[model samples]
Target: MQQIIKFFLRNKTFLLYVFLLFIAVVFTIQSHSYHKSKFINSANYVTGGIYNSVNNLSLYFNLESQNLLLQEENARLHSLLSTPNYSTSLSFISDSIYSGISYKFTPAQVIKNSYSVKNNILLINRGKRDSIKQDFGVITPKGLLGIVDQRSNKFATVLSILNTNIKISAQLKNTNHFGSLMWDTKSPQVVQLNEISKIAPLKKGDTIVTSGRSVIFPKGIPVGTIQDFRLDSAENFYTIDVKLFNDMTNIEYVYIIENVDKTEINSLLKPSNE
Candidate 1:
């Protein structure tokens, strides 16, 4: 205590000057309108900067969670694609189901992913309450994910594009030749475009995308472009390999597509078979 007192006494002159300076600055701000206004402006600027920094930090921290959510959505798509009947059309003839079409997107997040297996699945965190249901189409902003296979109130499963059984209706963007898209299980980034007519004038760089013939997706939903392909045995068709637009490894937010007229089309097709 005596040492502290001695130190304070020794620095009393400088301390007094500092104290007076502080008081003078406060008084000047309070007494002068211009000074007061400047002080308030300066204060606002400092506070605003702090607020902005805090907000940005919060946003950055939330990104990890957001990414996890996206993975879940992708997982749902993978699961749905695993189902055999996802695109096993009842139409044994020309795909007339494309006649009546309506589609809507319900957003979802993927939580899990698997592409190594012949059959792949993606789990998403959406359910019936969000208008998600079985057979709904899933896609990201970039391209197709898969299809929704089933759903509960809070979660759903998807048949991811990586799944072997997943079939998407696709066509050459420049021509009317359409076919079913499936995975070869050899490369995660590539899929097979089946039933493409040998006479479709296809080349290595030909772009292929969703035909959107049905209400499942909008027309021109990008699937991929032709990489390399060969004629199947019997040589009636070319199974062109497509490079998918959406990178299967990094999928996030997805829009679940519901065909509003699916029931109507299914109902109409019943009697044609008989």
Candidate 2:
């Protein structure tokens, strides 16, 4: 401290000049409206540029949070818009509410996903705490993502649609024909739906979607478009290549569907087998 005092005493002349210059600028701005206006404008310009650069730097790190927020909003909208009206107990595909099935979506973030492996799986950052659980169907806004295979309090693992073990009931849109959705394990973009009846009308671009044949997923959730089709050697069913609506390799967020009456549905099936 004493050394610093000595140094300041030695350079007091320069310091005094710097102090005087600061006083002169303040006085000039105070005395003249034009000078004050110019000073304020210059300060604003410099500070504005600084703040903008800082905001951009911070935004680059906050993209994941923004993405999750968007997914949450989408899920909320789906809760309202896509929810089926359950009225009749007979048909599953009712534009009105139907008694056979009901579901709600839980938005989730994909912290890890594997598409190249033969048994593909996705680890999502939503779990029992968020009402996500095993057997829950996962989907993005574009299409079906997969099925939840396991869960903890704060995380869930999904058997991705790209997995060879992944099988879900699906059907052609605008028709009652149903098939089994399966992945070939060769490409993440394509999956096959087998057992579509030969007599059902198969168009080049017909949409495929969840069939509600089982309780895993609600009917009419988009699967993909028919890319190509041909009868197997058995000639009893159509093997169709469906171009998936969701890009599995690039998924970041998804919605977990919890069938509202899954237990009741499963119990009824159990009694039939017994």
Candidate 3:
């Protein structure tokens, strides 16, 4: 206590001067309208900045929830768009009989993704319990991702487009020309489209999409854009390189697509001798 008193006494002259300066500044601001306005503006500016920082921090912490909500909304939108009678004014109807909806979409999160192997696979946070099944098409907002190949009670595996063993039926946009889409294991960003007829018009940057020839994916789902093309050794078909829109290595959210009429279609195509 004695040491503290001694220190305060020694610095009392300077402390007094500081206190007087603060009082003088306050008086000057209160006495002058311009000074008062400037002081108030400065105070407001500081408080506003503090509030904005707090708000931004809150938003950052809430990002995961916001993203989940967006994913669900996107799934709903995709379901509506896949319907044959979809309209802007139409409200979503879950009943297939009433809406004539042939496809259903379910949003899922990629719990694990692999793109560095010859046959890449993705694991999603949904399974048989969620109605996910083999041959269900998977996609992102930008492009196609994969198809579900296996499922358990609470999880499912997808055969990624990057896999060498998987082949998707794809066609050039605005035309009937279609080919088989496969991965060459060279680059994750590109896939190869084989068996496209040489007579079909080919151009760089031509958009490619699902052919809808199979019961897996509906027609017109985006695949990618043509990056390059060349004739095969036989000169009968063009082998085109496609630049995928989805970054396979960085996928997070996806939508699983179910074809409602798939069973009926498959049944009709079965061999009669069987």
lDDT of 1: 0.73
TM-score winner, 2 or 3? 3
Best first by TM-score, ranked = 3, 2, 1
Mark the 10 consecutive residues where model 3 has the least summed lDDT: 34-43
Q: Can you list the residue pairs that collide in candidate 3?
A: none
Q: Rate the local accuracy (lDDT) of all candidates.
A: 0.73, 0.76, 0.79
Model 2 alpha-carbon drift over 4 Å, by segment: 1-101, 272-274
Error of 3 at 185 (Å): 0.2
Highest-scoring model, TM-score: 3
Between the candidate structures 1 and 3, which one is better when assessed by TM-score?
Answer: 3
Name the candidate that leads on lDDT.
3
Off by over 4 Å in 1: 1-101, 272-274
lDDT of 1 by residue, 1-274 (tens): 9999999999999999999999878865553321122232211234434433554455564587557656765786688789777863455455567643366667766655567887676767677678776778888867888987655456666778887655789999999899999887999999999998888898888888889876577678878889998999989999998998777876656788888877887788668754
TM-score of each model, in listed order: 0.62, 0.65, 0.67
Model 3 — TM-score against the truth?
0.67
Candidate 2: worst-modelled 10 consecutive residues by lDDT: 34-43
